[model samples]
Target: MRAGRKYFIYDVFTQRPLDGNPLAVVIDSEGLDTAAMQAIAREFNLSETAFVLPPKNPTHKACVRIFTPDYEMPFAGHPTVGTAIALSEMAEGNDLAGIFVLEENIGLVRCAIDKLNNGLFAEFDVPQLPEQLPLSADPEAIGAALGLGPHEIGFENHRVSLWSAGVPYIAVPVADLKAAAKVKLNNDAWVEFSPRKSEFAVASAYVYGRETVDHTSSFHARMIVPGNPSYEDPATGSAAAAFAGAIMRFDQPTDGSHRFWIEQGIEMGRPSRIRLEIDVAGGKLAAARIGGHAVRVAEGVLLA
Candidate 1:
Protein backbone atom coordinates (compact mmCIF):
# COMPACT_ATOMS: atom_id res chain seq x y z
CA MET A 1 0.00 0.00 0.00
CA ARG A 2 1.23 3.53 -0.84
CA ALA A 3 1.80 5.86 2.03
CA GLY A 4 -0.90 8.51 2.19
CA ARG A 5 -0.62 12.28 1.97
CA LYS A 6 -1.61 14.57 4.81
CA TYR A 7 -5.04 16.14 4.83
CA PHE A 8 -7.10 18.33 7.15
CA ILE A 9 -10.78 19.18 7.64
CA TYR A 10 -11.84 22.61 8.80
CA ASP A 11 -15.13 24.09 9.95
CA VAL A 12 -15.22 27.50 8.27
CA PHE A 13 -17.11 30.76 8.91
CA THR A 14 -17.92 29.82 12.51
CA GLN A 15 -15.98 29.60 15.73
CA ARG A 16 -17.33 26.20 16.72
CA PRO A 17 -16.79 22.88 15.06
CA LEU A 18 -19.61 21.01 13.22
CA ASP A 19 -21.45 24.31 12.87
CA GLY A 20 -19.93 25.95 9.79
CA ASN A 21 -19.13 24.82 6.26
CA PRO A 22 -16.72 21.88 6.25
CA LEU A 23 -13.70 22.06 3.92
CA ALA A 24 -11.20 19.33 3.15
CA VAL A 25 -7.66 20.61 2.55
CA VAL A 26 -4.98 18.41 1.10
CA ILE A 27 -1.60 19.85 2.02
CA ASP A 28 0.87 17.50 0.39
CA SER A 29 -0.62 17.75 -3.07
CA GLU A 30 2.07 18.94 -5.46
CA GLY A 31 2.34 16.02 -7.88
CA LEU A 32 -1.42 15.34 -8.21
CA ASP A 33 -2.97 16.50 -11.47
CA THR A 34 -6.36 18.17 -11.90
CA ALA A 35 -8.24 14.88 -12.43
CA ALA A 36 -6.76 13.32 -9.28
CA MET A 37 -7.54 16.39 -7.22
CA GLN A 38 -11.12 16.33 -8.48
CA ALA A 39 -11.41 12.68 -7.46
CA ILE A 40 -10.15 13.49 -3.97
CA ALA A 41 -12.67 16.32 -3.64
CA ARG A 42 -15.47 13.93 -4.69
CA GLU A 43 -14.28 11.48 -2.06
CA PHE A 44 -14.47 14.10 0.68
CA ASN A 45 -17.90 15.09 -0.63
CA LEU A 46 -17.95 18.50 0.97
CA SER A 47 -19.14 21.74 -0.60
CA GLU A 48 -15.51 22.40 -1.56
CA THR A 49 -11.99 21.02 -1.14
CA ALA A 50 -8.63 22.85 -1.41
CA PHE A 51 -5.29 21.57 -2.52
CA VAL A 52 -2.12 23.45 -1.51
CA LEU A 53 0.67 23.52 -4.03
CA PRO A 54 3.96 25.39 -4.04
CA PRO A 55 3.64 28.95 -5.24
CA LYS A 56 4.95 29.75 -8.69
CA ASN A 57 6.49 32.92 -7.29
CA PRO A 58 8.52 32.15 -4.19
CA THR A 59 7.35 35.31 -2.38
CA HIS A 60 3.74 34.27 -2.28
CA LYS A 61 2.51 31.82 0.37
CA ALA A 62 1.13 28.97 -1.76
CA CYS A 63 -1.09 28.06 -4.70
CA VAL A 64 -4.56 26.88 -3.71
CA ARG A 65 -6.86 24.97 -6.02
CA ILE A 66 -10.52 24.85 -5.00
CA PHE A 67 -13.03 22.31 -6.22
CA THR A 68 -16.57 21.12 -5.79
CA PRO A 69 -17.27 17.46 -6.46
CA ASP A 70 -18.46 18.14 -10.00
CA TYR A 71 -15.99 20.79 -11.23
CA GLU A 72 -13.17 23.16 -10.38
CA MET A 73 -13.77 26.65 -9.05
CA PRO A 74 -11.74 29.71 -9.99
CA PHE A 75 -12.30 31.15 -6.55
CA ALA A 76 -14.44 30.60 -3.45
CA GLY A 77 -14.91 32.34 -0.08
CA HIS A 78 -14.88 29.54 2.49
CA PRO A 79 -11.93 27.79 0.90
CA THR A 80 -9.93 31.03 0.99
CA VAL A 81 -10.81 31.55 4.64
CA GLY A 82 -10.17 27.93 5.60
CA THR A 83 -6.97 27.65 3.61
CA ALA A 84 -5.62 30.92 4.98
CA ILE A 85 -6.27 29.78 8.53
CA ALA A 86 -4.78 26.36 7.82
CA LEU A 87 -1.68 27.89 6.26
CA SER A 88 -1.31 30.38 9.09
CA GLU A 89 -1.66 27.67 11.70
CA MET A 90 0.90 25.59 9.86
CA ALA A 91 3.39 28.41 9.54
CA GLU A 92 2.82 30.13 12.87
CA GLY A 93 1.51 28.79 16.14
CA ASN A 94 -1.63 29.90 17.96
CA ASP A 95 0.00 32.97 19.50
CA LEU A 96 1.08 34.86 16.39
CA ALA A 97 -0.87 36.42 13.50
CA GLY A 98 0.03 36.40 9.81
CA ILE A 99 -0.48 38.24 6.53
CA PHE A 100 0.25 36.48 3.26
CA VAL A 101 -0.72 36.09 -0.37
CA LEU A 102 -2.21 33.00 -1.93
CA GLU A 103 -2.16 32.33 -5.64
CA GLU A 104 -5.69 31.30 -6.56
CA ASN A 105 -6.90 30.37 -10.02
CA ILE A 106 -8.67 33.71 -10.51
CA GLY A 107 -5.57 35.67 -9.41
CA LEU A 108 -3.32 36.41 -6.51
CA VAL A 109 -5.46 36.66 -3.37
CA ARG A 110 -4.23 38.80 -0.48
CA CYS A 111 -5.29 37.31 2.87
CA ALA A 112 -4.88 38.54 6.44
CA ILE A 113 -5.01 36.25 9.46
CA ASP A 114 -5.82 37.10 13.05
CA LYS A 115 -5.64 34.85 16.10
CA LEU A 116 -8.60 35.54 18.33
CA ASN A 117 -9.93 34.11 21.59
CA ASN A 118 -12.76 32.24 19.88
CA GLY A 119 -10.79 30.99 16.87
CA LEU A 120 -8.58 31.99 13.99
CA PHE A 121 -10.17 34.48 11.61
CA ALA A 122 -9.00 35.10 8.07
CA GLU A 123 -10.12 37.68 5.54
CA PHE A 124 -9.25 38.16 1.89
CA ASP A 125 -9.76 41.04 -0.52
CA VAL A 126 -11.97 39.80 -3.34
CA PRO A 127 -9.86 39.91 -6.50
CA GLN A 128 -12.82 41.12 -8.54
CA LEU A 129 -15.52 43.51 -7.39
CA PRO A 130 -19.15 42.59 -8.02
CA GLU A 131 -20.63 43.50 -11.38
CA GLN A 132 -24.26 43.29 -12.50
CA LEU A 133 -25.32 40.98 -15.32
CA PRO A 134 -28.49 41.37 -17.36
CA LEU A 135 -31.27 39.06 -16.14
CA SER A 136 -34.36 38.91 -18.38
CA ALA A 137 -36.58 36.66 -16.22
CA ASP A 138 -39.14 38.52 -14.14
CA PRO A 139 -39.83 38.27 -10.38
CA GLU A 140 -42.69 35.78 -10.77
CA ALA A 141 -40.53 33.33 -12.69
CA ILE A 142 -37.65 33.58 -10.25
CA GLY A 143 -39.97 33.21 -7.29
CA ALA A 144 -41.54 30.11 -8.79
CA ALA A 145 -38.18 28.39 -8.97
CA LEU A 146 -37.65 29.06 -5.25
CA GLY A 147 -41.18 27.88 -4.31
CA LEU A 148 -42.34 31.38 -3.52
CA GLY A 149 -45.21 33.40 -4.96
CA PRO A 150 -45.24 36.94 -6.29
CA HIS A 151 -46.22 38.38 -2.90
CA GLU A 152 -43.39 36.58 -1.09
CA ILE A 153 -40.77 37.36 -3.71
CA GLY A 154 -39.42 40.77 -2.70
CA PHE A 155 -39.03 43.03 0.33
CA GLU A 156 -38.63 46.81 0.38
CA ASN A 157 -37.03 47.80 -2.96
CA HIS A 158 -35.06 44.57 -3.30
CA ARG A 159 -36.03 42.32 -6.20
CA VAL A 160 -34.52 39.74 -8.54
CA SER A 161 -31.00 40.50 -9.78
CA LEU A 162 -28.00 38.74 -11.27
CA TRP A 163 -24.46 39.52 -10.08
CA SER A 164 -21.00 38.05 -10.21
CA ALA A 165 -17.52 38.65 -8.89
CA GLY A 166 -16.00 35.58 -10.49
CA VAL A 167 -18.76 32.98 -10.14
CA PRO A 168 -22.29 34.00 -11.04
CA TYR A 169 -25.36 34.07 -8.72
CA ILE A 170 -28.96 35.12 -9.21
CA ALA A 171 -29.92 37.07 -6.09
CA VAL A 172 -33.60 36.45 -5.29
CA PRO A 173 -34.91 38.78 -2.63
CA VAL A 174 -37.65 37.24 -0.50
CA ALA A 175 -40.14 38.77 1.95
CA ASP A 176 -38.96 37.45 5.30
CA LEU A 177 -37.26 34.62 7.17
CA LYS A 178 -40.45 32.64 6.76
CA ALA A 179 -40.12 33.02 3.00
CA ALA A 180 -36.43 32.23 3.18
CA ALA A 181 -37.08 29.05 5.17
CA LYS A 182 -39.67 27.82 2.70
CA VAL A 183 -37.23 27.80 -0.22
CA LYS A 184 -37.23 24.57 -2.25
CA LEU A 185 -35.06 25.11 -5.30
CA ASN A 186 -36.23 23.33 -8.45
CA ASN A 187 -33.26 22.31 -10.61
CA ASP A 188 -35.09 22.00 -13.90
CA ALA A 189 -36.86 25.31 -13.44
CA TRP A 190 -33.68 26.95 -12.23
CA VAL A 191 -31.53 25.90 -15.22
CA GLU A 192 -34.21 27.03 -17.64
CA PHE A 193 -34.13 30.59 -16.23
CA SER A 194 -30.52 30.92 -15.05
CA PRO A 195 -28.74 33.77 -16.81
CA ARG A 196 -25.50 33.01 -18.55
CA LYS A 197 -22.63 35.48 -18.99
CA SER A 198 -20.08 35.33 -21.82
CA GLU A 199 -19.65 31.61 -22.71
CA PHE A 200 -20.29 29.91 -19.31
CA ALA A 201 -23.55 28.30 -18.19
CA VAL A 202 -25.32 27.73 -14.85
CA ALA A 203 -25.67 30.59 -12.42
CA SER A 204 -26.69 29.34 -8.95
CA ALA A 205 -29.58 30.71 -6.88
CA TYR A 206 -28.95 32.93 -3.81
CA VAL A 207 -32.06 33.71 -1.82
CA TYR A 208 -31.96 36.39 0.86
CA GLY A 209 -34.30 38.29 3.19
CA ARG A 210 -34.06 41.27 5.52
CA GLU A 211 -35.25 39.37 8.59
CA THR A 212 -32.64 37.12 10.14
CA VAL A 213 -32.60 34.25 12.65
CA ASP A 214 -29.58 35.79 14.36
CA HIS A 215 -30.02 39.35 15.49
CA THR A 216 -26.40 40.11 14.71
CA SER A 217 -26.76 39.15 11.06
CA SER A 218 -27.74 41.80 8.54
CA PHE A 219 -29.28 39.23 6.21
CA HIS A 220 -30.46 35.62 6.26
CA ALA A 221 -29.47 33.76 3.13
CA ARG A 222 -29.41 30.44 1.24
CA MET A 223 -27.43 29.24 -1.81
CA ILE A 224 -28.46 26.43 -4.14
CA VAL A 225 -26.26 25.07 -6.95
CA PRO A 226 -28.43 23.63 -9.74
CA GLY A 227 -26.95 21.08 -12.11
CA ASN A 228 -26.50 17.28 -12.52
CA PRO A 229 -25.70 17.12 -8.78
CA SER A 230 -27.79 19.98 -7.51
CA TYR A 231 -27.51 20.70 -3.77
CA GLU A 232 -27.79 23.42 -1.16
CA ASP A 233 -24.68 25.01 0.31
CA PRO A 234 -24.33 25.65 4.03
CA ALA A 235 -22.53 28.96 3.64
CA THR A 236 -21.49 30.50 0.34
CA GLY A 237 -18.85 33.26 0.20
CA SER A 238 -18.88 33.56 -3.56
CA ALA A 239 -22.64 34.06 -3.58
CA ALA A 240 -22.27 36.76 -0.94
CA ALA A 241 -19.56 38.36 -3.06
CA ALA A 242 -21.91 38.47 -6.04
CA PHE A 243 -24.77 39.71 -3.85
CA ALA A 244 -22.67 42.74 -2.94
CA GLY A 245 -23.65 44.23 -6.26
CA ALA A 246 -27.33 43.78 -5.50
CA ILE A 247 -26.88 45.44 -2.12
CA MET A 248 -25.15 48.39 -3.71
CA ARG A 249 -27.85 48.71 -6.34
CA PHE A 250 -30.80 48.76 -3.92
CA ASP A 251 -29.48 49.94 -0.56
CA GLN A 252 -27.16 52.63 -1.96
CA PRO A 253 -24.78 52.97 0.92
CA THR A 254 -22.77 56.19 1.08
CA ASP A 255 -19.09 56.50 0.27
CA GLY A 256 -17.49 54.78 3.25
CA SER A 257 -16.56 51.42 4.67
CA HIS A 258 -19.46 49.18 5.68
CA ARG A 259 -19.62 45.72 7.19
CA PHE A 260 -22.48 43.25 7.17
CA TRP A 261 -22.72 39.82 8.71
CA ILE A 262 -24.63 37.26 6.63
CA GLU A 263 -26.01 34.16 8.37
CA GLN A 264 -26.50 31.09 6.15
CA GLY A 265 -26.75 27.27 6.12
CA ILE A 266 -29.32 27.11 8.94
CA GLU A 267 -31.63 25.01 6.77
CA MET A 268 -28.90 22.37 6.45
CA GLY A 269 -28.20 22.34 10.23
CA ARG A 270 -24.64 23.51 9.56
CA PRO A 271 -25.14 27.17 10.42
CA SER A 272 -22.50 29.66 9.21
CA ARG A 273 -21.80 33.38 9.32
CA ILE A 274 -19.81 35.32 6.71
CA ARG A 275 -18.61 38.90 7.11
CA LEU A 276 -18.79 41.13 4.05
CA GLU A 277 -17.03 44.48 3.98
CA ILE A 278 -17.33 46.97 1.18
CA ASP A 279 -15.68 50.31 0.57
CA VAL A 280 -17.76 52.78 -1.34
CA ALA A 281 -16.12 55.59 -3.30
CA GLY A 282 -18.17 58.13 -5.26
CA GLY A 283 -21.26 55.91 -4.86
CA LYS A 284 -19.58 52.93 -6.49
CA LEU A 285 -17.95 49.77 -5.20
CA ALA A 286 -14.27 50.55 -4.67
CA ALA A 287 -13.28 47.32 -2.91
CA ALA A 288 -14.75 44.42 -0.97
CA ARG A 289 -13.60 41.77 1.48
CA ILE A 290 -14.95 38.39 2.72
CA GLY A 291 -13.90 37.20 6.17
CA GLY A 292 -14.73 34.42 8.63
CA HIS A 293 -13.44 32.18 11.40
CA ALA A 294 -12.26 28.59 10.97
CA VAL A 295 -11.15 25.73 13.19
CA ARG A 296 -9.35 22.53 12.30
CA VAL A 297 -11.65 19.71 13.38
CA ALA A 298 -9.94 16.69 11.92
CA GLU A 299 -6.72 15.52 10.27
CA GLY A 300 -5.83 12.29 8.52
CA VAL A 301 -3.70 10.63 5.90
CA LEU A 302 -5.26 10.45 2.45
CA LEU A 303 -4.79 6.96 1.18
CA ALA A 304 -4.97 6.31 -2.54
Candidate 2:
Protein backbone atom coordinates (compact mmCIF):
# COMPACT_ATOMS: atom_id res chain seq x y z
CA MET A 1 0.00 0.00 0.00
CA ARG A 2 1.16 3.52 -0.78
CA ALA A 3 1.33 5.99 2.12
CA GLY A 4 0.90 9.69 1.38
CA ARG A 5 -1.12 12.72 2.40
CA LYS A 6 -4.92 12.82 2.51
CA TYR A 7 -7.37 15.68 1.96
CA PHE A 8 -10.77 16.41 3.42
CA ILE A 9 -12.86 16.79 0.28
CA TYR A 10 -16.02 18.85 0.38
CA ASP A 11 -19.19 19.33 -1.64
CA VAL A 12 -19.14 22.22 -4.08
CA PHE A 13 -22.14 24.10 -5.64
CA THR A 14 -23.34 25.13 -2.18
CA GLN A 15 -22.05 27.17 0.70
CA ARG A 16 -22.27 24.37 3.23
CA PRO A 17 -20.93 20.87 3.33
CA LEU A 18 -23.19 17.96 2.26
CA ASP A 19 -25.42 20.44 0.45
CA GLY A 20 -24.04 20.48 -3.09
CA ASN A 21 -22.21 17.90 -5.20
CA PRO A 22 -19.23 16.37 -3.44
CA LEU A 23 -15.84 16.38 -5.19
CA ALA A 24 -12.59 14.69 -4.18
CA VAL A 25 -9.42 16.72 -4.71
CA VAL A 26 -6.23 14.69 -4.64
CA ILE A 27 -3.91 17.67 -4.38
CA ASP A 28 -0.59 15.82 -4.33
CA SER A 29 -1.04 13.15 -6.94
CA GLU A 30 2.41 13.28 -8.52
CA GLY A 31 2.99 9.66 -9.54
CA LEU A 32 -0.46 8.17 -10.04
CA ASP A 33 -1.51 6.42 -13.24
CA THR A 34 -4.87 6.37 -14.99
CA ALA A 35 -5.80 3.17 -13.17
CA ALA A 36 -4.60 4.57 -9.84
CA MET A 37 -6.51 7.79 -10.36
CA GLN A 38 -9.66 5.84 -11.14
CA ALA A 39 -9.00 3.66 -8.10
CA ILE A 40 -8.66 6.64 -5.78
CA ALA A 41 -11.79 8.16 -7.25
CA ARG A 42 -13.63 4.93 -6.52
CA GLU A 43 -12.31 4.92 -2.98
CA PHE A 44 -13.73 8.38 -2.38
CA ASN A 45 -16.83 7.46 -4.40
CA LEU A 46 -18.01 11.03 -4.81
CA SER A 47 -19.76 12.39 -7.90
CA GLU A 48 -16.35 13.51 -9.20
CA THR A 49 -12.70 13.46 -8.17
CA ALA A 50 -9.99 15.85 -9.40
CA PHE A 51 -6.25 15.19 -9.73
CA VAL A 52 -3.91 18.17 -10.06
CA LEU A 53 -0.72 17.95 -12.05
CA PRO A 54 2.15 20.32 -12.68
CA PRO A 55 1.89 22.35 -15.84
CA LYS A 56 3.31 20.51 -18.83
CA ASN A 57 4.06 23.73 -20.71
CA PRO A 58 4.83 26.88 -18.75
CA THR A 59 3.33 28.94 -21.55
CA HIS A 60 -0.08 27.52 -20.58
CA LYS A 61 -1.91 27.28 -17.27
CA ALA A 62 -1.78 24.48 -14.72
CA CYS A 63 -3.00 21.04 -15.88
CA VAL A 64 -5.77 19.13 -14.15
CA ARG A 65 -7.62 15.94 -15.03
CA ILE A 66 -11.15 15.29 -13.71
CA PHE A 67 -12.65 11.87 -13.20
CA THR A 68 -15.87 10.37 -12.01
CA PRO A 69 -15.33 7.36 -9.82
CA ASP A 70 -15.73 5.13 -12.86
CA TYR A 71 -14.66 7.26 -15.82
CA GLU A 72 -12.61 10.30 -16.76
CA MET A 73 -14.46 13.43 -17.92
CA PRO A 74 -12.74 15.73 -20.40
CA PHE A 75 -14.44 18.70 -18.81
CA ALA A 76 -16.79 19.40 -15.91
CA GLY A 77 -18.20 22.59 -14.36
CA HIS A 78 -18.15 22.15 -10.58
CA PRO A 79 -14.77 20.52 -10.65
CA THR A 80 -13.43 23.32 -12.77
CA VAL A 81 -14.79 25.93 -10.39
CA GLY A 82 -13.99 23.95 -7.29
CA THR A 83 -10.51 23.03 -8.38
CA ALA A 84 -9.71 26.63 -9.20
CA ILE A 85 -11.11 27.74 -5.90
CA ALA A 86 -9.12 25.06 -4.15
CA LEU A 87 -5.91 26.03 -5.90
CA SER A 88 -6.44 29.70 -5.23
CA GLU A 89 -7.12 29.01 -1.60
CA MET A 90 -4.04 26.82 -1.36
CA ALA A 91 -2.04 29.66 -2.80
CA GLU A 92 -2.61 31.56 0.40
CA GLY A 93 0.80 32.35 2.00
CA ASN A 94 2.26 31.58 -1.44
CA ASP A 95 2.52 33.45 -4.75
CA LEU A 96 -0.56 32.26 -6.73
CA ALA A 97 -3.64 34.46 -6.68
CA GLY A 98 -5.61 37.08 -8.56
CA ILE A 99 -5.90 35.98 -12.23
CA PHE A 100 -4.53 32.60 -13.30
CA VAL A 101 -4.74 30.24 -16.28
CA LEU A 102 -5.41 26.51 -16.00
CA GLU A 103 -4.06 24.15 -18.62
CA GLU A 104 -6.78 21.55 -18.40
CA ASN A 105 -6.85 18.56 -20.68
CA ILE A 106 -9.55 20.35 -22.65
CA GLY A 107 -7.38 23.46 -23.19
CA LEU A 108 -6.28 26.65 -21.54
CA VAL A 109 -9.05 28.10 -19.33
CA ARG A 110 -8.59 31.55 -17.80
CA CYS A 111 -9.81 32.05 -14.21
CA ALA A 112 -9.94 35.01 -11.84
CA ILE A 113 -10.24 34.77 -8.07
CA ASP A 114 -11.20 37.91 -6.15
CA LYS A 115 -11.82 38.31 -2.43
CA LEU A 116 -14.77 40.59 -1.90
CA ASN A 117 -16.22 41.89 1.35
CA ASN A 118 -18.97 39.34 0.97
CA GLY A 119 -16.93 36.31 -0.10
CA LEU A 120 -14.70 34.81 -2.82
CA PHE A 121 -15.93 34.59 -6.40
CA ALA A 122 -14.37 32.81 -9.35
CA GLU A 123 -14.93 33.69 -13.01
CA PHE A 124 -13.55 31.46 -15.73
CA ASP A 125 -13.79 31.44 -19.51
CA VAL A 126 -15.23 28.24 -20.92
CA PRO A 127 -14.29 26.79 -24.27
CA GLN A 128 -16.14 28.46 -27.13
CA LEU A 129 -19.70 27.21 -27.52
CA PRO A 130 -20.35 24.70 -30.26
CA GLU A 131 -22.55 25.23 -33.31
CA GLN A 132 -26.15 24.17 -33.06
CA LEU A 133 -27.25 20.95 -34.70
CA PRO A 134 -30.58 19.58 -35.89
CA LEU A 135 -32.82 17.54 -33.62
CA SER A 136 -31.19 14.18 -34.24
CA ALA A 137 -33.13 12.16 -31.69
CA ASP A 138 -36.52 10.74 -32.58
CA PRO A 139 -39.16 12.46 -30.40
CA GLU A 140 -40.58 9.22 -29.17
CA ALA A 141 -37.12 7.91 -28.46
CA ILE A 142 -35.98 11.06 -26.70
CA GLY A 143 -39.17 11.14 -24.68
CA ALA A 144 -38.75 7.53 -23.67
CA ALA A 145 -35.29 8.21 -22.26
CA LEU A 146 -36.56 11.22 -20.33
CA GLY A 147 -39.79 9.57 -19.03
CA LEU A 148 -41.82 12.24 -20.83
CA GLY A 149 -44.32 12.28 -23.68
CA PRO A 150 -44.38 14.70 -26.60
CA HIS A 151 -47.20 16.65 -24.98
CA GLU A 152 -45.03 17.56 -21.99
CA ILE A 153 -42.28 19.02 -24.14
CA GLY A 154 -42.25 22.63 -25.40
CA PHE A 155 -42.41 21.54 -28.99
CA GLU A 156 -43.13 24.99 -30.38
CA ASN A 157 -39.60 26.42 -30.56
CA HIS A 158 -37.53 23.85 -28.69
CA ARG A 159 -36.25 20.47 -29.74
CA VAL A 160 -34.17 17.66 -28.27
CA SER A 161 -30.77 18.35 -29.73
CA LEU A 162 -27.09 17.82 -28.96
CA TRP A 163 -24.78 20.53 -27.57
CA SER A 164 -21.39 20.90 -25.92
CA ALA A 165 -19.23 23.49 -24.24
CA GLY A 166 -16.41 21.19 -23.22
CA VAL A 167 -18.33 17.93 -23.06
CA PRO A 168 -21.55 17.12 -24.91
CA TYR A 169 -24.96 16.35 -23.43
CA ILE A 170 -28.35 15.52 -24.88
CA ALA A 171 -30.32 18.78 -24.49
CA VAL A 172 -34.05 18.26 -23.89
CA PRO A 173 -36.43 21.14 -23.46
CA VAL A 174 -39.50 20.69 -21.28
CA ALA A 175 -42.70 22.76 -21.27
CA ASP A 176 -42.41 24.21 -17.79
CA LEU A 177 -41.03 23.84 -14.29
CA LYS A 178 -43.40 21.05 -13.24
CA ALA A 179 -42.55 18.87 -16.21
CA ALA A 180 -38.88 19.63 -15.79
CA ALA A 181 -38.79 18.62 -12.13
CA LYS A 182 -40.60 15.35 -12.92
CA VAL A 183 -38.00 14.30 -15.49
CA LYS A 184 -36.49 10.82 -15.25
CA LEU A 185 -33.76 9.51 -17.54
CA ASN A 186 -35.13 7.17 -20.21
CA ASN A 187 -32.25 4.70 -20.41
CA ASP A 188 -33.69 2.71 -23.29
CA ALA A 189 -34.39 5.68 -25.54
CA TRP A 190 -31.16 7.31 -24.49
CA VAL A 191 -29.29 4.16 -25.49
CA GLU A 192 -30.67 4.51 -29.03
CA PHE A 193 -31.24 8.21 -29.82
CA SER A 194 -28.42 9.96 -27.94
CA PRO A 195 -25.78 11.41 -30.23
CA ARG A 196 -22.87 11.25 -27.78
CA LYS A 197 -21.16 8.02 -26.94
CA SER A 198 -22.56 6.05 -24.00
CA GLU A 199 -19.81 7.56 -21.84
CA PHE A 200 -21.05 11.13 -22.45
CA ALA A 201 -24.81 10.54 -22.84
CA VAL A 202 -25.47 12.68 -19.75
CA ALA A 203 -28.91 14.08 -20.54
CA SER A 204 -29.50 17.72 -19.51
CA ALA A 205 -33.21 18.64 -19.27
CA TYR A 206 -34.24 22.29 -18.75
CA VAL A 207 -37.23 24.68 -18.91
CA TYR A 208 -37.77 28.44 -19.02
CA GLY A 209 -40.22 30.10 -16.65
CA ARG A 210 -41.23 33.37 -15.01
CA GLU A 211 -39.35 34.74 -12.03
CA THR A 212 -39.37 32.17 -9.26
CA VAL A 213 -37.23 31.68 -6.18
CA ASP A 214 -34.83 34.66 -6.14
CA HIS A 215 -34.13 35.23 -9.84
CA THR A 216 -35.84 36.97 -12.75
CA SER A 217 -35.88 33.73 -14.77
CA SER A 218 -35.88 30.17 -13.55
CA PHE A 219 -34.22 27.26 -15.34
CA HIS A 220 -34.65 23.78 -13.85
CA ALA A 221 -32.39 21.01 -15.04
CA ARG A 222 -31.19 17.47 -14.31
CA MET A 223 -28.18 15.46 -15.55
CA ILE A 224 -27.96 11.65 -15.64
CA VAL A 225 -25.01 9.41 -16.35
CA PRO A 226 -24.34 5.81 -15.28
CA GLY A 227 -22.31 4.64 -12.27
CA ASN A 228 -22.22 7.99 -10.51
CA PRO A 229 -23.63 8.57 -7.03
CA SER A 230 -25.47 11.71 -8.06
CA TYR A 231 -27.44 11.23 -11.24
CA GLU A 232 -28.63 14.86 -11.13
CA ASP A 233 -26.30 17.80 -10.60
CA PRO A 234 -27.52 20.88 -8.75
CA ALA A 235 -25.88 23.47 -11.00
CA THR A 236 -24.23 22.37 -14.23
CA GLY A 237 -22.08 25.09 -15.89
CA SER A 238 -21.04 22.95 -18.86
CA ALA A 239 -24.65 22.08 -19.69
CA ALA A 240 -25.75 25.66 -19.05
CA ALA A 241 -23.18 26.95 -21.56
CA ALA A 242 -24.48 24.52 -24.14
CA PHE A 243 -28.04 25.52 -23.28
CA ALA A 244 -27.17 29.15 -23.89
CA GLY A 245 -25.73 28.18 -27.26
CA ALA A 246 -28.92 26.32 -28.12
CA ILE A 247 -31.07 29.27 -27.00
CA MET A 248 -29.14 31.63 -29.20
CA ARG A 249 -29.76 29.32 -32.13
CA PHE A 250 -33.51 28.79 -31.59
CA ASP A 251 -35.03 31.63 -29.48
CA GLN A 252 -33.24 34.98 -29.66
CA PRO A 253 -35.22 38.24 -29.63
CA THR A 254 -34.44 40.76 -32.35
CA ASP A 255 -32.46 43.15 -30.10
CA GLY A 256 -30.13 43.33 -27.10
CA SER A 257 -28.38 40.70 -25.02
CA HIS A 258 -30.08 37.37 -24.30
CA ARG A 259 -29.78 36.98 -20.54
CA PHE A 260 -31.43 34.32 -18.38
CA TRP A 261 -31.19 32.61 -15.02
CA ILE A 262 -30.55 28.86 -14.83
CA GLU A 263 -31.65 26.94 -11.73
CA GLN A 264 -30.69 23.37 -11.01
CA GLY A 265 -30.37 20.90 -8.06
CA ILE A 266 -33.55 22.13 -6.38
CA GLU A 267 -35.33 18.82 -6.76
CA MET A 268 -32.36 17.17 -5.09
CA GLY A 269 -32.67 19.76 -2.28
CA ARG A 270 -29.48 21.60 -3.34
CA PRO A 271 -30.65 24.65 -5.26
CA SER A 272 -28.05 26.17 -7.65
CA ARG A 273 -28.08 29.42 -9.59
CA ILE A 274 -26.23 30.19 -12.84
CA ARG A 275 -26.27 33.26 -15.10
CA LEU A 276 -26.15 32.70 -18.87
CA GLU A 277 -25.40 35.26 -21.59
CA ILE A 278 -25.51 34.88 -25.34
CA ASP A 279 -25.33 37.27 -28.25
CA VAL A 280 -26.84 36.50 -31.63
CA ALA A 281 -25.71 38.58 -34.57
CA GLY A 282 -27.01 38.58 -38.11
CA GLY A 283 -29.19 35.54 -37.30
CA LYS A 284 -26.11 33.57 -36.40
CA LEU A 285 -24.99 32.55 -32.92
CA ALA A 286 -22.14 34.94 -32.20
CA ALA A 287 -21.06 34.73 -28.56
CA ALA A 288 -21.97 32.40 -25.66
CA ARG A 289 -20.83 32.47 -22.02
CA ILE A 290 -21.74 31.64 -18.40
CA GLY A 291 -20.57 32.92 -14.97
CA GLY A 292 -21.25 32.20 -11.29
CA HIS A 293 -19.87 32.39 -7.75
CA ALA A 294 -17.98 29.60 -5.99
CA VAL A 295 -17.28 29.42 -2.24
CA ARG A 296 -14.83 27.23 -0.40
CA VAL A 297 -16.48 24.87 2.07
CA ALA A 298 -13.34 23.05 3.25
CA GLU A 299 -9.88 21.83 2.28
CA GLY A 300 -7.43 18.92 2.81
CA VAL A 301 -4.41 17.22 1.27
CA LEU A 302 -4.11 13.89 -0.58
CA LEU A 303 -2.09 10.97 0.78
CA ALA A 304 -0.50 8.60 -1.74
How many collisions per candidate?
A: 0, 11
What is candidate 2's lDDT per residue for 1-304, written digit by digit as tens? 2556555475665555566666777776667889998988888877788888788888654688888777788777777777877787777586435887877767777877766435455666666666565556676677666777778766467776777776666677777667776777755555555555335444444443332555555455666662223266667777777777667656655545677777667778877666676766777666655555556455655554
The C-alpha TM-scores of every prediction are 0.96, 0.85
By lDDT, the best candidate is 1
lDDT for model 2, please.
Answer: 0.67
Q: How many Å off is the CA of 180 in candidate 1?
A: 0.5
The C-alpha lDDT values of all candidates are: 0.90, 0.67
Candidate 1 Cα outliers beyond 4 Å, as residue runs: 92-95, 196-201
C-alpha RMSD values across all candidates = 1.8, 3.1
Maximum-TM-score candidate:
1
How many times do residue backbones clash in model 1? 0
